[model samples]
Target: MSSGHTAVTTALQPCGLPEHRNCGIREVLDRIGDKWSVLVIAELSPGTRRFREIQRGIHGISQRMLTLTLRRLERDGLVLRTAFPTVPVTVTYQLTDRGRSLTHLVQQLADWSLANMAAVAESRRRWDAANPESMIV
Candidate 1:
């Protein structure tokens, strides 16, 4: 309330319009939009796998990141985690029905990425070549 300042508000757009409300698809994408999430789903698409197996299947992922990603997926009901009593206790992660359904969509995205990665790379190269100043060291 100082310096003659006043709060301003604007009317929100209609819910049916994407600009106004949070879209359901956007919410779902937010849940799994990370690169690691897609890769993790791909690794688990075949069948149930233990934590170590999943980690080994997807290279370049740190243990902490993997744990966090799995926890998020589990919380979203897209993955099921089972732990077995053993000397050190063993745990496995498997896709739930919902998760399996999502695999197909993620696979399509993977296919698209594979098919178009070269084109995307070429576009980036052209852009960088045209605007050298934009390139970061």
Candidate 2:
């Protein structure tokens, strides 16, 4: 492997265990790397937002899915959920300090994806043309 690859692998596996056994990174990634979580995080990044606002901001996300996403993010300590006593109830969500720290990384990834989207699409088109039988969908 390249020295840079080795360095990254070593850094990620600081516990000296196999990559599969490294639950920290895997678990966290499994949470934040999900399709909805990043969007939810980015939605909450600007400031606090109500449930309906978040739902409105992210297209195609059902109410149930948004509820579940917020619950998971809250459970993971990446989001802070506040409830206010009102006629019904007012709930707001914002990123915790840890979540804010992750926002930078997420934003960087988002920027990178936007910057390389055309290149990636072209690459995929070429690959798909060359390997039509290998295409899943």
Candidate 3:
């Protein structure tokens, strides 16, 4: 409850409907660690986007998850949602500066996933070969 960090903590307290209390950068990490959150961040990292674009970018993400993720990011002030003055009312989502800064970390994780999948697949093959009897399930 110190006076100095109250505002900062209030802003970044990203865990479970964060309060206007003190929280640090580590809190942001915990919030984004969910698989859907990570994937959403990865999908949107490149640039601003419409809902359809985001849906297309992330393979197999249900519409519900994308909507929820965007709302959370917006609440965290990590995302900027712009509504256009158009016939149907177009909406676009982009990272705020804070969110943009996360691009590198997300990209690195995406790279690692690309990398580790092959290793995992190879490992699975080896494991299966050695444990054929366990495959009955």
Candidate 4:
């Protein structure tokens, strides 16, 4: 909700103030707002991939979290899940058209984080070095 992109569109103006304010965008933002969801969707962009494949591709994502996030994505129509009619029944997740559209924005944010992390780290280091009061003396 903090981001301006979550605001309702001009097409919703006919709905009046209250109804427009509560437009469906809130749910969409809430779903994609988490970093894990962005990464998960991005990983699925290359092609349909199994649960384990996605988990392995994105480091530090726990199995439980991956399951929950994927379910949410599927529920939101951002991802499609298919269970193969095999002896073992394999399942795969892939981005829907809507989810694919988010790739550039999500990828840009990731790139920006990678590019700026060093400067941000340096700023934090400087602040910590200057503020000795907060540290254990």
Alpha-carbon TM-score of each model against the true structure: 0.81, 0.84, 0.68, 0.77
Q: lDDT of each prediction vs. the true structure?
A: 0.89, 0.89, 0.81, 0.88
Clashes of each: 0, 0, 0, 0
Lowest lDDT sum, 10 consecutive residues, model 4, at 7-16
lDDT of 3 by residue, 1-137 (tens): 67665455355344345473465656776677777778777777778889999989888888998999889988988889999999999999988898888779888987888989999889888888889888543
Taking every candidate in turn, the Cα RMSD to the unseen true structure, in Å, is 10.4, 3.3, 10.5, 6.5
Estimate the overall C-alpha local distance difference test score of candidate 3. Answer: 0.81
Residue 35 error, candidate 4, Å: 1.4
Among residues 3 or more apart in sequence or in different chains, the pairs in candidate 4 whose N, CA or C atoms overlap within 3 Å are none
Best by TM-score: 2
Error of 1 at 2 (Å): 49
Ranking by TM-score: 2, 1, 4, 3
Candidate 4 residue lDDT tens string, 31-116: 89888898898899898999999999999999999999999999989999999999899998999999999999988988999999
lDDT of 1: 0.89
Across 54-119, the per-residue lDDT of candidate 1 in tens digits comes to 999999999999999999999999899999999799899999999999898998998999999999
